[model samples]
Target: MGWLSDSPQLLILKDCLARRLLSCHVYPELRNLPESAQGEELELADFSAFLAQEVWPTLPPSFREASFETRSALPDDLDSVPLDSTPVSFVDTLVSYGITADAEGAQTLLRKVLAEYVSDACAAPPVWSSTRARECEICEREIPLTYHHLIPRATHAKALKKKWHPASMLNAVAWLCRPCHTVVHQIATNEELARSYHSVDLLLEREDIQRWGKYASKQRFGVRRG
Candidate 1:
């Protein structure tokens, strides 16, 4: 077993890789960072501090207590089970961490996480239900609508280090038609839209012109616009 103290470099690298995995899901631009980049040297203490301060709180309590040893010990062929059973708030978190698992297991975990988060996030209260049939964002087609997290759930799961709860980070979304949904992600992923939609608050806010403005203002990669 690799003790946290004995293999600080390896631990840090693994943590960085985990973070990058999550980032790729949320920030399309980050998907391009070389997988090798995750191996770059970083102080274990500094990385731990970042994880504790920024990442831990976002995770469900079960994962909060998970150690590198426990994770590494998980069987490669662990059967597909309900994500809720894993004790993580978001399904994506579990899936991301389970990347080392087999392909079938990974897909099972990813689907469950995505479905659960979407159900919870978009479960409209009675009052909001009536307004769900508005036109889509791109083609303006009138239909039953839902909020699409501009950041993909897979990506959001990794970025927030939390489950894919819409209520928890609703700001990272867009009011889009199903067709527009695809368009928006394409725009966000390869173009500048991902950077523009980085704000946690605006993304969660009710999709409106104002929120889009805030998203637009911050649309550059690696730089936070004031």
Candidate 2:
């Protein structure tokens, strides 16, 4: 919060992290910052402004509303001052208020915040959805379900492609939530799907898939969906 502006070292670290994000391949223009930032003479302040103004808009739908405020600072005069033309660094603003953040202490504090953010994200599901009708046979995750073609649809499509044969196994379908569906497709090949892994029971036979489903539940203890 206040520390974000109070700690010069922390602000610099955050700017560095954001720069790495800018050079990510997903962004078209700034994929190579060395080339893109060549004429700009951008420093940490420029990048922070770029992140909020330029980059924030281009972020995918999932991250658009991400809150950058880690501290509770008054918003009364924020709109009056232009962020880019602000005369000095954030640390200087804190100095005006008699606040000081040591570099070593700031670095340690930054790491703790970062670690907590990541840990909290991983330890629990961020958002939850439900199918409402039924549970997944694999993970038992209650999210939306789709009718999976237990015998790979690709196999059915291939038969139609090569010999003009219609889909023969019309009854081969399973109810799977999104995550389970993804896991099933990922762990098994198309040949395995048509030959052996054609039923929910057979799929559960693979110890790894079963083991994974067991741990993927919100509780981290697997629940079988019969």
Best by TM-score: 2
lDDT per residue for candidate 1 within 12-118, as digits (tens), equals 33454345444434333333334424433333233323333333244344233223323433333333323334224233433444442444553453444333332
Clashes of 1: 13
lDDT of 1 at 129: 35
lDDT measured at residue 209 in model 2 versus the true structure, 0 to 100 = 83
- lDDT, residue 109, candidate 2: 29
Ten residues in sequence with the least summed lDDT for candidate 1:
1-10
Clashes of each: 13, 2
Q: Which of the numbered candidates is closest to the native, going by highest lDDT?
A: 2
RMSD, one per candidate, in order:
17.9, 20.9
lDDT against the true structure, each candidate = 0.39, 0.47
lDDT of the structure predicted as candidate 2: 0.47
Instruction: Write down the RMSD of candidate 2 (Cα, Å).
Output: 20.9
Please write out the lDDT profile of model 2 over residues 16-84, one tens digit for every residue.
544543443433333334434534434334444433343222323222211222122323332232233
